[model samples]
Target: MFVECCGCKYYHDMPSNIYEAMANPEAVIRPRGNVGFTGALSMTVKCPWCSHEMSTKCCAGYAAMVYVKERLH
Candidate 1:
């Protein structure tokens, strides 16, 4: 699936499952402009199977969780 950031033109390839995507560090972060704020921007993506539009919260949360898990291990 493809994910596009609503705040910017940034886009990424998302895995079918959140956990799987989280496993890859590179897939978790995207370059964002200096908005002088800290939070995940909303994003919309087209579903490859049905061409439906989908939305997700900030990816930062997912990345942070994964980082925490890794540190604990």
Candidate 2:
């Protein structure tokens, strides 16, 4: 599938087993990162077309969780 974020586009190959997961209408965790003193950060996005899952970061913490929940559902 293809995703557009912040004016950038990302493409992901749907794993045979996870293809259905992409249609769950919920956001799924994608990637994680650290923000040193802030602890961790994360980014999350909803597939605008399918309402699937996508995320990134590690230190963003609750912000990430909130983003996931808000964007997915």
Candidate 3:
């Protein structure tokens, strides 16, 4: 599984179990810290390609979410 950055179209690799995450009726997927997502969501992330701040409603490690890719953009 993988995700893409809306800005750059960069693909972010996702977990193999991602299908299950989407299959669960109770599973909620939304960008982390994104107010657009209501209630407790899944993950927070940043774009490695464009250095843009981003979030996802999937399972991504915190290590992948720590880069500050903005301001330089």
Candidate 4:
């Protein structure tokens, strides 16, 4: 997945382990230094290139969730 930086307009590629981390929080690296994400439907992540904060809901993760919900129901 790619995260676009609002500051620099850079698209940062997300780690491949992100899906595993979403399913199991303990399985991924914390890029933003102990940002708490417990019980949250979405998260705030920093743009790797520009250090600009962005919402995870804008990413494909939420779309994937919607797709899964549609497929399941």
TM-score of each: 0.26, 0.24, 0.33, 0.34
Better of 1 and 4 by lDDT: 4
Model 4 C-alpha lDDT per residue in residues 1-73, reported as the tens digit of each score: 5555556767656665554453344343545545666433444366666665554444344322213445544
Top candidate (TM-score): 4
Which residue pairs in model 3 clash with each other?
30-57, 51-69
Q: Native-vs-model 2 lDDT?
A: 0.36
Task: After superposing candidate 4 on the true structure, give the runs of residues whose Cα lies further than 4 Å from its correct spot.
Answer: 16-43, 57-73
Q: Which stretch of 10 consecutive residues in model 4 shows the poorest summed lDDT?
A: 59-68
* Residue-wise C-alpha lDDT for candidate 1, range 1-21, written one tens digit per residue: 445544454555665553233
Which tens-of-lDDT digit does each residue in 1-73 have in candidate 3?
5566666876766553443443353556644454664665553345657775544453333224556667854
Query: What clash count goes with each model?
Result: 0, 13, 2, 0
Candidate 1 structure lDDT: 0.45
Each prediction's Cα lDDT score? 0.45, 0.36, 0.52, 0.50
Alpha carbon deviation, residue 2, candidate 3 (Å):
0.9
lDDT: worst 10-residue window of model 1: 58-67
lDDT of 2 by residue, 1-73 (tens): 3223322343444443233333342534333344345432233345454554444321111211113445544
* TM-score, prediction 4: 0.34
